[model samples]
Target: MKFTRTANANWKGTGMEGTGTISTQSTTLNNAQLSFKTRFAEGVGTNPEELIAAAHSGCFTMQLSFLLTEAGFIPEDLNTKAKVTLEDGTITLIQLELEGKVPGISEEQFQELAQKAKAICPISKLLNTEITLSTTLTA
Candidate 1:
């Protein structure tokens, strides 16, 4: 199962004064110098880091839900947010937070499922960064 999405950037000049397009659709065009950069989440344009975080969070939550269902439990609600922090010009995925509710499941069981899902999820696999995280389950 090989999956892929492509984004290419063409920078005509230096770091701050360059511009690029992600994908051929021109749906996402950016110029760092002009501050015309469009955020991936806003869907107003293109930003690579936002895109990466969105992908990670989306994939992880889906994987968690499926795994929980396979474990004979269904989540009442599942919400996960992943933060990809770029600090001092170095990018690091610093934290992840998962909050959810599952009926008739022990905290231990919930944690077991969460750990399994986190470890095996495609986004988690793609990440080489260490995660400082927390998860909460209730009801």
Candidate 2:
């Protein structure tokens, strides 16, 4: 099983003052604006770090849902946030914070499963940065 995703970017002018747009094949983003201001300072548009955070959070949440179901627990709700840090032109770390409610699961069991998912998720395995998971389980 193989899947491929595509996104395209177009830029005009120099890095400091240039503007660009990013579009993905899925059309989730179509000509979305981006610029140096957007990346390094306050501006209107999306940046690569934001996109990575979105992808990591979505992937980790889905993986947790699958793990909970496999463990015979019905997931009520799951929310995850992935924060990526960039320093000195390098991505330093990604922190995943999750809060979940599930029926018929102990906190220890939920934490175990959440850690398993964090270790096995595709994006987690793909990234070269340090990844950390913090989970809060609610009855």
Show where candidate 1 strays beyond 4 Å. 1-3, 8-13, 24-46
Q: Indicate which candidate wins on TM-score.
A: 2
Overall lDDT per candidate, in order of appearance: 0.71, 0.93
Highest-lDDT candidate: 2
Q: What is the lDDT of residue 122 in candidate 2?
A: 98
Give the count of colliding residue pairs in each prediction. Answer: 0, 0
lDDT of 1 at 79: 91
lDDT tens digits by residue: candidate 1, 1-139: 7856654665455544455555433444333222134532233455666667777788888998998899899889999888888666566665778898988889888888888878888878877888655789866
Q: How does each model score on TM-score?
A: 0.74, 0.96
Candidate 1 lDDT trough over 10 residues, lowest sum:
32-41
Give the alpha carbon lDDT tens digit for every residue of 22-76 in model 2.
Answer: 9999999999999999899988899999999999999999998998888899899
